[model samples]
Target: MKRIVFFGDSLTAGYGLHKPEEQSFPALIQRELDAAGLDYRAVNAGVSGDTSASGLSRLSYWLSGPVDVFVLALGANDLIRGLAPSGTQRNLQAIIDQVKARFPLVKFLLLGMQLPLWVPGQRAAEFRQLYRDLAAENEMPLLPFLLDGVAGIKHLNMHDGVHPLAEGYQIIARRVWPVLQPLL
Candidate 1:
């Protein structure tokens, strides 16, 4: 089966879930692929508290295997830690570049993230635009925000008010399927 790597932070890792292996968005997508008769294996490569730089540093391990599609969902930690958008974008771009160099035919689906408007300064706006710019430069399909309907919804997220619950992941899987399915 072909491999689809879901690379990101705690959200991709399904942090705090009782069964992340089975309930994470990547896992949910795996089930969807199976139900749809798609011959693809979803690989969750998310690391909690990981920044884009960390991801870039550890990318070689994920690249060891054959990759058919790359789903990038990083940068949340960067935003939380108040990192520079330029650095985040550069690190993310490097990850994509390395993956492309290894697997030229691999498709990419970028999962975007946004900061709350309450966050002071222009950083919030810049953070939001970086994803769009990256998608445009890479010519990849972009999911405006990974937590679209789930974010800020009391019932959807866990107590942390950051990560989502299983139901929330299900919503994410649903939102991702349309864009992801077309690529497959």
Candidate 2:
């Protein structure tokens, strides 16, 4: 069986949600795999409010031994906290490099994040390009925006509007499954 590690912040962790096992995006992906008769494990490495640096810090824990494919979803918290975009990109790239140093054959899928258009367009564009540039450099499948169709939708997000609701995760699962299906 193949294994895919999902590394991300609050979104991956399904923060503020009433249930994780039922509503977490990773779990939803697992269901997809099951229905497709794919023998795969979707390991949820999500940490609530984790920054890129934080994800890098937990590197050894997730990348140890062997990891078939990595679902790298991070940088949102870093952006929220106004951390340097270069730092986020560097940390993420370093993680992939380190994993390759050990596993050599591991594949990757990076989940990109974005800020609202109301924010400074220049800074936002730079942030958006970070994912694009990194994915291009690493040749990883990049999900342009993890919150692509769900963000800013009143019914799709929770009351806090920072996290997705059940329906939102379903949408996320649907969007990601296309790229993830063959891998599993």
Cα lDDT, model 2, residue 126: 84
User: In model 2, what lDDT does residue 50 have?
Assistant: 95
Go through the candidates in order and give each one's C-alpha lDDT.
0.95, 0.88
Model 1 spans with C-alpha error above 4 angstroms: 117-120
Query: When superposed on Cα atoms, how far off is each prediction in RMSD?
Result: 1.0, 1.2
**Model 2 stretches with alpha carbons more than 4 Å out:** none
Question: Which lDDT tens digits does candidate 2 get at residues 1-184?
Answer: 8888998999999887788877889999999888988888888899998999999999898866468888999999999998888898999998889888877888889899988767876678789889999999998888889998999999999988889999999999999989877555
Q: TM-scores for all candidates? A: 0.97, 0.95
The TM-score obtained by model 1 is: 0.97
